[model samples]
Target: MKNKLLKITTNLWFDTQAEEAARFYTSIFENSKIGRTTYYGKAGREIHGMSEETVMTIEFELEGQTFVALNGGPHFKFTEAISFIIHCESQEDVDYYWEKLSQGGDEKAQACGWLKDQFGVSWQIIPENITDMINDTDPDRSARVMTALYQMKKIDINTLKLAYNE
Candidate 1:
C-alpha cells in the first residue's frame, strides 16, 4: 500500500538514513509529515546487505508532494542534475529554507539560489515571479536582473526587484 494516495512520488535513494532524512524533510516544510515506514525482512536483508528489522524505506510528504526514501546502499548518490525547487513567496521563506537546508550542507555549491544540503540533495530556494521578472520584455531590465541573479547565492527577492525596476 505504499502507492496509496499518491499518483506519482519521488524516490530518494539513501544508504541507511531514510528515516532520519524523512524526519528532517518533514520538519522543514508546512503540511509535511513522516508517513509509513517499511523494514527489511530476512529475504530483504540477504539481498540488500541490511540486517533484519532494519529500516528499508520511509514514506514522507513535504507540502503535499510525496517522496520515498530507500535505504538501498551507497551504490546511488544525489547529483545536482536533479534538484528540488522551493518557490518562495517572500524573503523570509527564502532565508529560512536557505538557512535550514544548507546548515550542514555544502557551502561550495551555494550559487544562484542553489545549494546542496548535508544530505547531498540539491535545492533551489527561489522567489516566486522571478521568471517573469527576469524575463521581462525590456532587454536592459532583463539583462540587469540576470546579472543580479548570477551574483546571488540565496536569492534576495528585494534585490532582484530593485534590479528589475532600476
Candidate 2:
C-alpha cells in the first residue's frame, strides 16, 4: 500500500513542557514518535522572551497524525472548546486511552468521554459505535444514548449499546 501525503498538522501550545507532553503522548499511543527537537535561539529570545537554548518545539506524530508541540510560554492555555477525538475500536481501547490520557490531569473535567490531560489539553476518547448509535434513525433511541453518555465520565461501549437498544 502506498503512504498518503499528510496535508494538515495540529499544533499544540505549552508553557514549558512541550517535550514532556510529546513524550507522554507518544508513550500512550501506538504508531507515535517524538520527532525533531529544536531550541530557541537569540532571535527567538527577542521575539518570545524565551531564553536561548530552551526547547522551542517538538515535532511529533501520534497514531499517524502529525503535530507540533510548542514551548511558547504561559500566555496561552488549552480550553474545552477544542479537543482531540480518539476513535476507539472497542471498549478496551477506550478504557486504555482514557486511563492513560487522564492521569495527572484534572479528574473533575472528565465527562462525556472528554478529559483534560496534565498539560490542560482536552481529549475525547470515543468508542466507534457511539457515533453510529447516537445517530440512529430512531430519535428516541439516539436521545437515550446521549442521556446515558452525559451521565458518565468514561464512556462505556456496552452501556451505550444497552441504551441504544432501550
Candidate 3:
C-alpha cells in the first residue's frame, strides 16, 4: 500500500522558537524527526522585520503526525482554548509524558491532567481509556472517576481504576 499524505497538519506559531520547540518535541516522542527548515530572506522584509537567513519555519513529525513550527513573531500567544492530548496506555506512559512535557512549564496551569508547557502550549496527558471511564453507563462510577481525575494534576491510572471499581 502507498503511504498517504496527511490532509490536515498542525501549525505552531512561535516567537523565534520554531526550531527550538520542534527539536524539543521531536526528542520526547518516539519515531519523530526534524524535516525541512525554511529561512527568511529579503522577501517580505518590510512587514516581517526579521533578519535575513533567520529561521522561518521548521517541519517535524511526531508519532506519524506532521507539524510545522513557524517563527511568526510575537503577534499571538498560546492559550488553553486549543490544546493537544496525549493518550497513554499505561501509568508509566502517563508519568513519562507528564514529566517530560511539564518540565519548566507553568505550575498554575496544571490540573486534571492538563499542563502548559514552557513553550506556552497546552497539553493534556490522559489515559487512553479515559473516555471509556468517564462515559461509563453507570453514572455513579463515572462520577467517582471524574472526582478522582479532578483531584489530580498528572493522571493516576490506579486512582482512576479504584474510583471506577468503587
lDDT for every model? 0.92, 0.93, 0.96
Please provide, for model 2 over 1-166, each residue's C-alpha lDDT reduced to its tens digit, 9 standing for 90 to 100: 4798748989999999999999999999889988999999888466799988999999999988999999999999999999999999998999999999999999999999999999999999999778888888999999999999999999998888889887
C-alpha lDDT of candidate 3 relative to the true structure: 0.96
Model 2 clashing residue pairs (backbone): none
Query: Which window of ten consecutive residues has the lowest lDDT sum in model 3?
Result: 1-10
* Clash pairs, model 1 backbone: none
Between candidates 2 and 3, the lDDT winner: 3
| Tens-digit lDDT track of model 1 for 105-163 | 99999999999998899999999999998778999999999999999998999899999
Q: How close is candidate 1 to the true structure, as a TM-score?
A: 0.94
- 1 or 3: which has the higher TM-score? 3
Let me know the TM-score candidate 3 reaches against the reference structure: 0.96
Candidate number with greatest lDDT: 3
Kindly give the stretch of ten consecutive residues in candidate 1 with the minimal lDDT sum: 39-48
What are the per-model C-alpha RMSD values against the true structure?
3.1, 3.0, 2.5
Off by over 4 Å in 2: 1-6
Ranking of candidates on lDDT, top first: 3, 2, 1
**Ranking 2 against 3 by TM-score, winner:** 3
